[model samples]
Target chain A: MKKHIRKTAVLSILTTVALVLSYVEAILPPIWAAVPGIKIGLPNIIIIFILYKTGLKDAITVSVIRLFLVALLFGNAMTLLYSAAGAILSIALMTLCKKINLFSMVGVSIVGGVAHNLGQILVAMAIFETSQIGYYMLVLAVTGTIAGVFVGIAASIILKRFEKIKI
Target chain B: MKNNNSQKNQKLRNDIILAVVIVFIAAAGLLLFVLTKQEGSTVAVKIDGVVTDTYPLSENREVSIKTGENDENINILTIKDGKASISEADCPDKICVETRAVSFVGETIVCLPHKIVIEITNEKTDDQIDVAV
Candidate 1:
């Protein structure tokens, strides 16, 4: 019973950390070199960490909650739909990868990242009411891979340390 | 374990293929941007559903369009002779501004929140007979 409580508390703390990281990322100046919508996706590290530590359910919960709160706080209602689409798609892809054991945390992260971009593009297309904007998808996919690999490496390090921690 | 290993390898190969395809598409887009260059088209700026200004596209120009009833200010667009680009935007993330110029058929510039869109269409002529009629 106590273990369950501890897990819940840890999940909440991790969610808070993810929220803060997302806010910080929002404030940072974007480094737009190759693509327009590309960013480092720094907040994804926390999501990856939570996925490795707790499990898929907790990770999904964290992702959905973080997305909702972040959108509300930012007051960008349109973004809420986009973020939800991306988060759900990413989590679904990561969970599938986990089930198949087709890759390590890094692999799953990469898949999630790519899926997130796909989801965002889908939303953009719907919003724009035109499919011509699909040209941007290729750029987003490449950028998503790079960001995913970075987050995956960070998740691996955190997971390793998490295994050693007693509490 | 063997099945898992093979499956993992397959997924990795798939991702690589996907990445390659994306790269090819990006390269094609870059080529297209280079190939179909045009000069000097008239651009009209609209903010929150109202026509604000019109200008000729010769060189990059940035104009600010303020959202009515809100403090939000969006860069109207950049124009360079028959080509227009979204140079900057006040909205969060500025995703629209990052979009490339509309040089091809059926291309559009959109700011969803602001309900602003600038589209490029073939000029219509009154003398042209309607084939469907």
Candidate 2:
């Protein structure tokens, strides 16, 4: 019963956090003038923290749930599809890199960020049915790397406390 | 598990390498973009993936695009000196207004919330046609 309560509490708190981050980002003004798709990706910090504290299964669950919730509440069908692709790809890369354990939190997040931008570009290409949008990827990658490093730092700091409170 | 100094050094090196590679990739991508951009004089305004209007870059004009669904929605695109840009938009984000005027082929200004796109199309030049014809 204790374990059940802990899991539920953690899940709900993380979900709420993820939602708040999404809401804040939506309302915030555009950060990068050159790249419209670029976002600070604050939600990824929560996703990464959860991944580090728990495991891949729980992490994926949280991410997918977060994506759908944000989509339904604040986005359209196309944006939903685009964001879903980015989330899945980022999570998958983060999981694989985390398993390897060769790099630090920052390095892992750098990979995740690059993969996230790639996933979004792939979806954009599919939606427009054109390869002309390739140049935009570079802009996205630059912004993603910057945002990822910030998130990685935040995640690392938060994960340090999880060790003491491990269930 | 206690990691020794060597492990720390290795991890640091890995992070450096990763960061360097991404920077290199971004630089290359930027160079490719600058080199591959084409000049186009035709601009097409599209909504919901369909073209709603087409304009020439050479003419200076103000075109106000209205969404059929929301009558109040308005995005004013302006063209001048062979370039086009969104001078004003009533959308929430107003990101389209931030984008610089574009004269190159395949360049675009997108308002995601509005589902609007303005893309430049290449115009035919007389030098390409055969003299015999």
Candidate 3:
């Protein structure tokens, strides 16, 4: 019971952190006005950390909760659809990479980032019903990779510091 | 200690490999799109996945496209000097407005919230009509 409580408390705190990071990302001005939907994916740091320290189930639970809350507060149905697709695909791929244990935390994060962008582009293509916008994926891939590297580095640092503490 | 050091090096190598692979895939996809591109002679406006209008790229003009159930949504498309762009839009994101002018075939400016797609096409009206006839 005590262990369970500790786990619950940690997850709730992490969920709140993810929510706050997402809010900060939403408020920040577009990194490049010319490019739409470009985000640093700040919330992903918490996601990666949870995946490494806790497990896949907890990470996904926090991810879905954060997505729903963020959408309800700051977005609409359309935004929710796009983000849900991205989040699902990203977490799946990230889990696969972590399970393989071949790459470091940074690598897993990069895969997650790239997968997230690809999922969103696929959703856009389906909605527009035109392959003409496919080129936009290339631009996004570059940005996503850069953002992933940063998020991965940050997650690794956090994981190292948290190792000394029990919970 | 030596064994642990080598294991760390192996993981680092794997990370570099993953990064390289993603970069290669992105580059290849970009090249494919570039090779398939050609200068378009007409601009096609699609709403709800249907072609609603077409304008010659040579003619300079501004067209206001209104959407939504009550015609509340608006996106202004401008064609000048053989290039087409969305100069204004009332959509929430304004992504279409920020997209640069497109003159090549298959290039598009899409407004997801409004379900608007402006694409450049190489098809001439005469060819389209000839095929239809």
Best by lDDT: 3
What TM-score between 0 and 1 does chain B of candidate 3 receive? 0.86
lDDT of 2 by residue, B37-112 (tens): 8889689898877887888888899999987575678999999998999999989778889889999998888876
Deviating ranges (above 4 Å) for candidate 3 = B125-133
Chain B alone, TM-score of each model?
0.50, 0.85, 0.86
Best by TM-score: 3
| Stronger candidate by TM-score (1 vs 2) | 2
Task: Please provide, for model 3 over A26-120, each residue's C-alpha lDDT reduced to its tens digit, 9 standing for 90 to 100.
Answer: 99989887667777889999999999998899999999999999999999898898999999999999999988889998889989998898888
Q: Estimate candidate 3's alpha-carbon lDDT, on a 0 to 1 scale.
A: 0.91
For candidate 3, the docking band is medium
| Model 1, runs deviating above 4 Å | A33-35, A165-167, B1-80, B85-101, B123-133
Residue A64 lDDT, candidate 2, scale 0-100: 84
Q: What proportion of true contacts does candidate 2 retain?
A: 0.62
Q: What lDDT tens digits, residue by residue, belong to model 1 across residues A104-145?
A: 777777778878888888987776555655766767777787
Alpha-carbon shift of residue A113 in model 1 (angstroms): 1.2
Q: Between 2 and 3, whose DockQ is larger?
A: 3
DockQ score of each predicted structure, in the order shown: 0.26, 0.56, 0.71
Candidate with top DockQ is 3
